[model samples]
Target: MVDRYVAAVDQGTTSTRCILFDHAGRLAAVAQREHRQHLPRPGWVEHDAQEILRNVLRVVGEAVQDVGAGPGQVVALGIANQRETTVLWDPRTGQPYGHAVVWQDLRTEARVEELAADGGRDRFRDVCGLPLTTYFAGPRIAWLLDATPGLRDAAAAGHVLFGTVDSWLVWNLTGGPDGGVHVTDVTNASRTMLMDLAGRHWSPALCEAMGVPMQILPEIRSSAEVYGLTGGPVAEVLPGVPVAAALGDQQAALFGQTCFAPGEAKCTYGTGSFVLINTGATPVTAEHGTLPTVAYQIGDEPAAYALEGAIAVTGSLVQWFRDGLGMIATAPDIEGLALSVPDNGGCYIVPAFSGLFAPHWRPDARGVVVGLTSFVTRAHLARAVLEATAWQTRDVVDAMDADSGLRLTSLRVDGGMTSNNLLMQTVADVLGVPVVRPMVSETVSLGAAYAAGLAVGWWPDLEGLRRNWHRAGEWLPHADPAAVARGHEDWTRAVQHSFGWSREPSSHDGGAPSAQPGR
Candidate 1:
């Protein structure tokens, strides 16, 4: 059943999207649905795992139906979900115990502080390419077990399944009421603190340290391997379709954008912006606390490793301007309004609304805006917000280069935010490298397409995806070094002003994580 098309279900932070690609790597159809984000308390974020699963089913069905394809026509399914969004579910019934604790949720900040205070925060860079923080799944899962009553019982009964969204959906889709496969791809597993980077399996030491049991975990597998066919109730849409790939959104983007060579990088501008540098076969253990994780795994490529840089707030900040403050009518309107001002006009925003990530793992860091003057208008604030995203990413790229030794010459940019030409050009000017935008901004979906195609023989391997890749636009270095330097200096000072402040309880006792403390 080699239909000329591959389907990708990209379950992203703000939306669930499905994209269909023909045999030649051309996009045939796309379906997107925006779901709700529940913020019950400040500094907390959540999504309904069941609702997300529903969206994935609905969108994929519509995409295939619009393309006039059936189960036999759609050869394989690849899933790339928002990484680090932790889900704890009843393995037997496929029901989430509570809302999916979003990657952005800071409810675990106190837990991270508890670990750090107990000396567990010391040199976490060894096995898990991350520190003790709320960003990863370990703390969130612990919070659920300790805080959610039924969870501990479920875990002890061996019925609780812990996973990022990829594992959750895969289990539900292929994991049936009778018996569905419970597995997670390596790329997504790397983000959880449980997996050992070198061994590429759940680490006993890590599980013990994080107060989690090994029994409830899923068997970790590679990104491109066929977990199973989509044979559950959702199969009502595309019956008997092979689910070939499951990757974290960032790794999927890296693969989808053809960043195969070492040092190749891509920046995804979603709810939170992510910058990942492909370090190739060998894992680059971050000397400076930049996340080191698996990029992706294919047939026998060993596990391609990567260095990750995360900006906890990117597109979400734009949402703040649109929804919270009512600055702009829509998200896209931000680029034009920000372009109205040449600069931040002495206003700088550090969106540590939860806590800052990457290079710096401070859970006490808080969002700050410095140098707000009487002359500051919505446009200046808008420009500052856009520039803030660029600045944070620039710091991440710098840290990535330092740690990986891959002199990043350019960055492939995707996600919802890259549509802003002003932001892309500004990111280029600040980083002093070309920022490339691809023909398909939905790199997650495209990466999923590549994976599903390869597994089912609709497309070749990574090289085949590379050959089919093409660029739509590129933002070259557009700022003088001196000007960028001065702007950065001002940004650095404002950053220092925002350090040690947090949206956490007083136990953590500092601001939420600060900016990447000056390289």
Candidate 2:
């Protein structure tokens, strides 16, 4: 019997999650599995693409089975994925040439340096709406082609395909090694640094400049449209279910937060934290460190654009406290440890683990812990860890305000970290704006489900999605104005100590060429 349920596959940097949403936009069942993050060397990160594929299949089956729903009950499937992670696979065998290069990986730093030498960073910003940074997939894809043996020739011959996580899953879901559809939504394509922002297609000049073959690029489609039906192992759980929507994780959260109108904003705190403000219809070229991207595109409506502030580290700071420092047993223990200390105790931590992103695109920066004295304890360090997350949000929020000319009075926030009352209140205090959390914290997956449901007539239009949103709670600013100023002042000083720490002795600048844009 036909039913009105949508399945969303939220493929993130650290885990794969599958959520089933009922007609009213409530979660019926959910399942998630964390994958291994391979650090072959310092400043490098990777994931086994094939393992992610297996985990995705596992979670989808588990979520669907939890609610005792058959394939007929699941009307469609949508995808929301960690953007800019480059994956290259063979079309003939459906096997990745190597482990997927994560967005946090710095393996392509030298390549970006070369691009910066030729022209200081904003070389392709006009056409592609991105800068010459390792944060994008273009350089990573180029590095994969150069580092992997014979991959370039194979790409040139069209034997290989290149895509972010979404394309990899969509191809495998449709029917890997057979005739699966190879496509990605506009939101994902916008991050590749190879797609034309205005044209909404691959830019030939930028592609050639980045040394990527155009033949391997996937077809770009609207965020809310049926790309193909599920096949292969995915078909076993929901055969013939239409895979209707695909969006980058940040954009998915924006959609899920119901930030439909212009100037509406949201910050998603996950492995990384991102601040995106919606700029309706026409794209705004960013002069600040912010990058302009497509929020989402419906069937016939003009594409909505966004100005994004991408922070390289947030939740990962907590992970380091747990795993690297051995300060806590689990991820949640940091909050308790942090609460033991009233303040940061004159210490600050700049988690430039893979280098700082947004506002300060200093790729040469490394993680730094400043103002440490004999009096400091693990509790103080823990407080600094949580404080780092809040300060980083302020960095992006300030940049967003400058680029968009709209000051945010309140922020709609979601993700795993929103559960921490201390972090939420700190964010409010740091930004001087109310931090609002939605009743449904799983906005990432819900956004994908909403897009897919809209495509297949499960939800008629935007009004239906707006009706599904409701606030769960809020955090108002409580910190004294003087304290806030002093905290931000110390944070600024600590961040300065982090810059140029990772570069060679001779390089005073952040490893980029001395030439600035227009020089």
Candidate 3:
């Protein structure tokens, strides 16, 4: 008998990856390719949507080929993508109007500010469960309409379509212009700021507020269900496999971690770090700057909600150290260089590269490296880089605790960055919680596979998935309390310095920007 497998395409901010998994949830084969990140302006970030689609198709073919599996043996394809990366395309020609506005891009800051001024931020809180920030897709799409000529008119006329990365990949995979299903999962739709949290559908009111026509929105569906079959160029490789599941990457990580019960939480350290704590069926309006989002919805089951704290830069900070500073030849080299120093040497590297996100929401903020002195070496900066990742995780975990009232004694961690022992230990030390890395660190992809596999009856149920999860390693907090406090104090001071750097005097009334009105 031939062994059946599920393929998961995880399209992330920095790269695209495909992983094949067997029934046991073991990774059979994997392929990845990094793409260009177009930083056209100080606060603008873009990606070629077509390039991402090409990378996705290539990696999927490579992974399946490496595993010696035919398309028939592949039960289904699951998609987990970087959330909130907006792409607008013409359905007729299957070409994007322009580059995708990345989630980290702050190009929508002024637009978000305009909406916030009109009481748009808090007004939709009850419906969408998100604030007006550059982090969500609504503002970015709105900005695209105003910035891109003829695009808005086309969208209004139903000639153009809008989707986050997951929707884009799924559209092309199914058939693109040739009868491809245009849809987004509930989890992805929740981040768009146009979906009603309780109703689980597009809100015409919010659409009017953002000036986005409802005609261009994708159909909202559950996280696990057959959206369509592979077609077009994707059919050349994955011919008829059903697209069984689609999830925002972080939510996929949560499911991949088997955090099925309320209060169970996980933090995925990828291009950015997201800490999501399951809140069960009821959406908890966050009071601590955390965003309320859909976790996942399995077949006819009620949608699960999560209180999320998102940090826009984590692993990418290491990337900058490699590419920008040339401190390390590769990403992995940073771990060794960071360990060379006993500490950060009192330095704090706050990488607000696209401006601060989550808990702060300061789009005016810029990257700042504080406490730099003549005595500081490259090793100290490297250590600071790793420390920043830990501190940022602590910031979200702290807010998650405050909002959910669930004290996190341990964190279920996944993603590429979790492989760094030094970074993992620092995370444990800073958060004062045990950090557990799963045996299969590709939980993001596995989560996608789990959803698809479950849909096709590849796995019996959630209990089967629970048994598949096993911890590979663990880290416990060993730092002294005083040291942690001192480090955090200095980190807070450094973050303060980063704010108000790019904002016009009028934006802040010639004073420091006020805390975003509500959590």
lDDT of each: 0.82, 0.88, 0.87
- How close is every model to the real structure, measured as TM-score? 0.88, 0.89, 0.87
lDDT for model 3, please: 0.87
Flag the better candidate by TM-score, 2 or 3: 2
Better candidate by TM-score, 1 or 2: 2
Which ranges in model 3 have alpha carbons more than 4 Å from their true place?
36-42, 146-153, 316-355, 364-384, 482-519
Q: For candidate 2, lDDT tens digit of each residue in 1-519?
A: 454579999998889999999988899899999999999998788999999999999999999989888758999999999888999999999999989998877788778878777766777888888777777899899899999899999888889999999999999999988888999999999998899998899999988988998999999999999988888888998899999999998899999998998888999887777889997887888876788999999876789999988777888889889999899999998888889889989999999885677777776778999999998999999999999989989988888888887778889999788888899999999999899999889999999999999999989999889999998989999899899999999999999989787655332232222111100
By TM-score, who's the top model here?
2
Worst 10 residues of 3 by lDDT: 510-519
Model 2's alpha-carbon lDDT is: 0.88
* Error at 16, model 3, angstroms: 2.3
- What TM-score does model 2 achieve against the real structure? 0.89
Residue lDDT tens for model 1, 1-519: 455578899898889989988887788999999899999998788999989988988898888888788657888889999888988887677788889998877788777776778655543557876666666888788888999867787789887888899888888888555578888999888888888888898899888888988888888988887788887777887787888999988789899998988989998887777788989888886766477889998855688899987777888889898999999998989988988877788899988775667656555767898998899999999999899899998888888889988898899988878878998999999999899998877787889889878887777677878878788998999688999999999988887777677544444332125122110
Order of candidates by TM-score, top first?
Answer: 2, 1, 3
Q: Please give the RMSD of candidate 2 to the true structure.
A: 4.1
Candidate 1, residue 256: lDDT: 91
Ten residues in sequence with the least summed lDDT for candidate 1: 510-519
Distance from true position, residue 130, model 1, in Å?
A: 1.4
User: Each candidate: how many clashes?
Assistant: 14, 0, 0
